[model samples]
Target: MSTFGELFRVTTYGESHCKGVGCIIDGCPPGLPLTEDDVQPQLSRRRPGQSALTTPRDEKDRVTIMSGIEFGTTLGTPIGMTVPNQDQRPHDYSETDLYPRPSHADWTYLKKYGVKASSGGGRASARETIGRVAAGAVAEKYLKIVAGVEIVAFVSSVGKVELPYLEALEDGQPIGKDFSNFLDHLTREQVDADVTRCPDPATSERMKERIMQAKEANDSVGGSVTCIIRNCPIGLGEPCFDKFEATLAHAMLSIPATKGFEIGSGFGGTKIPGHLHNDAFYRKADGSLGTVTNHSGGIQGGITNGEHIYFRVAFKPPATISQAQQTVTYDGESGTLAARGRHDPCVVPRAVPIVEAMAALVVMDQFLIQQSRQASATLLAPLHTPHHVLQAKPQPTV
Candidate 1:
């Protein structure tokens, strides 16, 4: 249950206040170069205490590679890794014994397990994501090498302060020219330029204040992250089920606090008529098929079509806030529970790396599946149909 993927599997371990947390990545291609340095940078980005908007847990999240590599290259076996929890504080969570924090996983976890972690949310904690982040880094490296894949995610909204262009851009609009251009050319450096990670200098400053306002009031705020995957290989999704976007949604929602996922036009596409929503195609300079509009978000019929794949993930305000709440204990006794622990006032900024990592894992897994299918198909003779007919526009199969 802790693992993900079919061919490119990853199994994560450890808990919120445990000895450490990490994952084992299986089915990685051999001879690909890998090292702790490649994995550490992303972990550092997801680590707490980096900025005022995030938690102050003070973990270095230093990763150590245990196996599946030799001389800095993956050995095509299961790659095991771990990150120590230096600042773990079980004592800080004593209040959980008397009361279940409202909107958190505390009560449901206890009900399901009979005995939960002695401290904190245990497996439900954001600390659990340490393993996910580490595994994602490995997948990212492999994806980059094999396909020049570029997966980048950034904070697009914080509470009510949406990115300037995105404010009027959603809900049946043409996804303005500015946002389209930004998605094609934006880099991580531009995203990291501010702690909020909103990219626009002025907008990012506003997001900072929004988070500070929540922190000052001992409350929490929610936001969304927009991720784009460029140079994605064609034909990576499965039909009927297991669509590429479906897997992406599954992966993103698996992260702590994620509540919503949307791809391409998402809900915004609902209002438009079929004529405007459809992506018209044409011949590219490379003599391949291309879409004039990207309303499809680089996918059609549940498969990739070679354009950029983009989506947004929304996270609810963290449940473990410093503010007091009226709630009942596990015994149904009433109490006023005020949680005590370091938590992000706004998790959107730190979530940037996590989103990117999960996207990489999805792409890495889907790519491997598609690659194997292609290899299997190559062994047989070509179909009797002419090659030109196969390349022609959509044919009537129904």
Candidate 2:
């Protein structure tokens, strides 16, 4: 099932070495401004050959809009978008027609379909994600304008390195009157200077040294990504079938090479007692509810509590290692295989944007659900209140 969500659904199609890949978005609200231009930036972020650490497949990934829009506004119909594959080297995998790459989907795909596309893992390639990222950008724009929510994700860990919480690093920093500007000036290269995205100078250097060593050896490594979503409104999920966390996990795990996911305290919480792991609630000065500690990761009972949504996703190393390894052919003949291709030594750095894109997709779906249920005038009455209330008066001399 390529489609996801009951409302605001999206279905993706195409193969790795095919002429193009695309997605069809259904249930998008009518009159929302959308265009191919709005979706291009995010696709560029995930396209191959963007940097030294990604696959060297050079694809321009130019997107085209086939339908569902006119005059830059969506028509509440299915929106179809596609990106043509500019640089395709299908001949690279031609020699392995009968042999399957170890740890790849080639064997299973053949078994499931009786035949498989021979070019670059076909639909299983990370290239399929191009469509998802494109559609997700549209969802993100809608969420930002209509829901007032923000989602940000960065490479928190690569191999053994991990970044410290942003709040902790900002403490005791002496910035002269412009804290936001100070943060904005920090580049990814400066962050990478520490190795684990940790912001701790010493620790990051050690992590970078480790990565450099691995790169020299033609080896690869993997790590985790942390995503933080802020300003998510309360009550944005279904209870029984499609819980917020479950839907989120499904969306993330669907990404190629993602191995594991955990929210809040996650696996570590199991070792601690309930008293220690539970988030304590309190009333704020503004009379809104708040959690003293977000050990529950800003979600409780399958619903948002207006707190930051934090989660971590673990990714495995790239499978296309240069080292020769043992493998078998389609006919069960054993042989040795040495991977030959340009691939990432570590996928963590590039995965940061993918994580943010998936998070945006999940949040946008939830926000659409929220809008549908609260469209009634009575439910939206409180949202129109003024800071200073004025009493109602009788009309006179009209």
Report lDDT (CA) for all predictions: 0.87, 0.74
Model 2, 3-122: lDDT tens per residue? Answer: 876788989999988989999999888888988788887777667776555677888889998989999999999999999988887877764686798878888899999989887777
Candidate 2 lDDT (Cα, 0 to 1): 0.74
Candidate 2 wrongly placed segments (more than 4 Å): 165-207, 376-398
Steric collisions counted per model: 0, 4
- TM-scores, in order shown? 0.96, 0.84
lDDT of 1 by residue, 1-398 (tens): 79989999989999989999999999988998999999999999999999888898999999999999999999998899999889988999998888888887888888887878878888888888888888888888877877888988999898989886555546566665677788899999889888888888888888899999999998899999999999898888998689999899889999999999988877777766789888889999867788877878888989999888999999999888887789887788888988889899888899999999899899999998988877787799955667667555431111
